[model samples]
Target: MKTKKILIVGTGETADLAYEYFTYDSEYEVCGFCVNRQYIKENQKCGLNITAIEDIEDKYDKEKYHLFVAIASSKLNYDRTKVYNELKNKGWKFASYISSKAFVWHNAQIGENCFILENNTIQPFTKVGNNVTMWSSNHLGHRSVIKDNCFITSHVVISGFCEIGENTFIGVNSTIADNIKIAKDNFIAMSAVVNKNTEENGLYTGNPAKKAGISAKEYFGVL
Candidate 1:
């Protein structure tokens, strides 16, 4: 089989890790990096030229290489979602990077442009939606649904039958009990333990988590 070439659409820390994962673990060879023209300071990155998005197509045709948006979970993953959708609408293809060491059930359904890292246990009948990022060592329980553009950080434990809403960010070491439904655009802060259903845009924290005074949108300055 021919190894696919990939162009990462950021020059940040996430992108650096993505390049390493894709290059070493996956069948994709990262040929270069791309970012908005204003942010281009270096002539090259990781021994490849950093091309501006404005000139990307002319230099590296989309037909030959796919893209991966490697931005972190800033603004509850709004920025990454925007870039992924924008690129898709413009006819640029995307590539998902799932780590080799991750344990995924046979019946699990994962979608496009996902970045799944090592030790993630995506259990039976799980549905992971498009453009989701599951960082290292998360336990996604059976029949759980992770919606599009959500970010699940490392070492989190999401129990069975849970539904994580779109544009949500589950922070590092968080725990969601069984049957919990985290609402859209919400932020579950680091190590928070959520046992009940969350409201849309709610900021949840603490054990048996309660909604904070400020909305998740307000806390992230996304609106």
Candidate 2:
């Protein structure tokens, strides 16, 4: 089989990690890096030439190479989502990667441009939406719905029948009990135990998660 050439779009730590993973584990070849011109401090990243996103199609033929936008969940995921949407509008073919070490149930449905890392177990009937990132060692229970552009960090436990809303960020070690409904634009802190529904654009923390009087924008800063 021919290896798929990939252009990772970003210059941050997440982009570096994506280069490592796709280069070492997956069949995709890391061709180069892409970033907005204003943020291009260096001409290279990960030993590959960095190109402006505006000149992406001109430099790399989209038909021959796939694109993966490796951005962290900044500004409650709006930053990543913006780049993703921009590339999508330009009719770029986005690449999604699921680790071979992950145990995703055959019945589970995962959407496009997602990054499902190692040691993650996604149960049956689970639906993971587009541009979602599930880091290593997480448990996504059966019948759960993780909406678009959400980022779930390491070691989080999301129980069965739970609904995680769009563009939310669930911090490392957080736990969501079964049947809980987490609303849109939420920032759930580390080690939070959410037993009930959450309000939209809220910040939640502690064990038995309660809304911390701060908006997701206030907690995550400007997009």
Candidate 3:
């Protein structure tokens, strides 16, 4: 089978990692890197030439090459989400990557522009939304719903029947108990344990995951 050519949008570490993973493990061939002209600091990244995002369609031809926005959560996850939406509006198709080493149940559903890394287990009946990122070694329990534009770091455990809201960032080593509903735009700090429903735009920290005085505004400069 002929591998489809893909252009990853970003020139940072995440883009480099995406290039390596797509090159070796997936049926996609990464041909180049891209970022906004203002963000381009180098001519080359991961051994590939970086193209200005404004000129991406002219150079790569959206019909011929798919795109994967390899940008991490920035500005409360709005940065990556905005880029994804813009490229999508321009008629570019985003690639959804599920590493072969990841264990995703047959009944699980994943949306476009998602990146599921190695050692991740997405149990049956789970629903992962678009532009989501699941780092390595995480366990997504059965019947859980991870909304769009969320980022889940490594070693996080989400028990069954949980609902992680859109644009939420769950840090490493966090444990979300079953039936918990994490509200939108909340930040779950490392080593936190969520046992109950969260408020929207809440900043949670510590073992029992109490609301921190630091608001989401502190992290994103906006609510």
Highest-scoring model, TM-score: 1
TM-score of each: 0.97, 0.96, 0.95
Tell me which residue pairs clash in candidate 3: none
Full-model lDDT, candidate 3:
0.91
Task: Score candidate 2 by lDDT.
Answer: 0.93
lDDT of 2 by residue, 86-186 (tens): 99999888888899899999999999889999999999999999999999999999999999999999999999999999999999999999999999999
Number of the top candidate by lDDT?
1
| Steric collisions counted per model | 0, 0, 0
Write model 1 residue lDDT over 1-223, tens digit each, in one string: 3389999999999999998999889999899999989999998999998999889889988799999999989988999998888889989988999898999999999998999999999999999999999999999999999999999999999999999999999999999999999999999999999999999999999997989999999999997
In the range 1-223, model 3's lDDT, one tens digit per residue, is 3378899998878988898888888999888899999998989876888999999877887778989999998877888999999999989988888999999999999999999999999999999999999999999999999999999999999999999999999999999999999999999999999998999989999878899877774767754
> Candidate 1: lDDT over CA atoms?
0.94
**Candidate 1 wrong stretches, greater than 4 Å:** none
For model 3, what is the error of residue 6's alpha carbon versus the real structure, in angstroms, after optimal superposition?
0.4
